[model samples]
Target: METLYDSIRDKTRVFERTGVASFSETENGVQVLTDNGKRVEGSILVGADGISSTIRLPAKYRALVGTSRNQFVENPKLPFLARGHMHNVYYEGISGFCVQGVQGLVFWCLFFKEEAWPDPRPASKFTDADCESVITKYGHLRLGTHYTFSDLWQSRVNASMTVMEEGMIEAPWNRGRVVLLGDSVHKLLPLLRRSVSQLPSREELAEAFARYEAKQRPRANICISMSNLAMRFETQDSWWLRLARRLVPSIPEGAWMPFFVEYITSAPRLDFLARESPVGRAHDLKSR
Candidate 1:
């Protein structure tokens, strides 16, 4: 993990006190303002600016990003709350979202089909009461009477920065002293698992990414495509599927440990990878 800037600074804060108002690039490198108007130079500029990355734009990112695209949106106001009604409607053209808050709060989530919704629009522009009118047409979920609308009515301007989908390049990333990392490299895909470690070193980071796109893209897309081809599955409605999901005990036995292996035993894949690499000599002795 990269060290935070504060640790390297003197006991007194080292930042220019004022925040950067603008960013400019020159032969020296990317420059940001200091409270004192001094310029700071960075050798390898890291753009951790997040999903709305200014680093990525129409120029170098011409083929990469290039356009504003809508991805997902949720309305804050849910007139009728249905707890755990959120279904990842894989069947319909769009993904369906439903949530029921514990208190009086009601929230709604939905995924529009690919190229379904346009971007650069404020997300919160529509209030929940307004959304009720839109969602009521979908199904017989009985959302019309299922909510506590009064307490949730404490509201304000309904609008948001519309999220957009990004186009990935066949060979999109540039490599050198300067390269993008984290969300910059990969479009902000939701995490696979909380246990999965995301930190990739600059080198392993770049190589592993290309390796992921090359090797994993096929399987990953296939899973989503299969789900896309399927239908919106309501657990209560889908008896068997819902039963399996509910009864699925994530007993960590077979998954974390391989079949027919000793309790304190070594992992086959781990042993193999370590053996093929310089690190395997250590594992060989341990397994013996």
Candidate 2:
């Protein structure tokens, strides 16, 4: 994340610690008013304010997530940590995944089913005690054969708890010079990305936004459906789910090669950027 931020830092001007109060379209561009009484001018506004953006929706699940200190280096008794590999488990009504990130920094998330909030809003901040409470409830759960969830919790450097909202805003994503982005439009358990740009007139900007929405909405819908299906398979108590979960462990690594090949072949590329040659099996399949 730091590397990605640094790559764009020279080309982008970022403003932090301020909230958008309001915005208005101008003859030339757009004017934005910040909560701190600052005015900014831009060709367009992209609201990437996450799930709690303009239209608020209730959350069906609350998750605890955190990054652990380099456990491989810190705890010699632990098993070898493999970078980029994820360890996941699905138990009835409780499911999570833990991964050893770059430099043996462990990252994880545990999702707990919760009653939906009546009003849409940001999740209340959690204290250290709140994290401890979660650990106390599910600490015994094992990640793989070697380490339990508690093992990861004890070495935590930072942690957070957030309500996970799931839905899409069906309203028009853009009005005049401003457009909605990210979780503001579609809040899915899976990740998706989109991009936009500047245009001369309000009509042109609106057209661009419409085109962006048209191209991206179908992808978001498919991802959200997949997420919901996964959640049901992981957390629901159906007999079919039990059988499916039991069958997962026996599935061979080669069985998943086709899915990976399809994912790579279907991946979206930036049309404005110069094209790069595809490689490996995806390229072979495309050549056919």
| Tens digits of lDDT, candidate 2, 66-102 | 8875464466556435767788888876788888776
**Pairs in clash, predicted candidate 2:** none
> What would the per-residue lDDT of candidate 1 be over residues 1-288, giving only the tens digit for each residue?
235564574644445334456556555345665656766655334443453444333211000001111111234443333444432222233333334434443353333322232222233242444344334433333223442222222231221222333333335443432434344544423221122334334555456445534543443444444333232232122446445444545656677344324422332233222344465454354366
Error of 1 at 72 (Å): 26
Number of clashes in model 2?
A: 0
Assess every candidate by TM-score. Answer: 0.36, 0.64
* Cα lDDT, model 2, residue 145: 80
**Candidate 2, residue 158: lDDT:** 82
Ten-residue region with minimum lDDT total, candidate 2 = 188-197
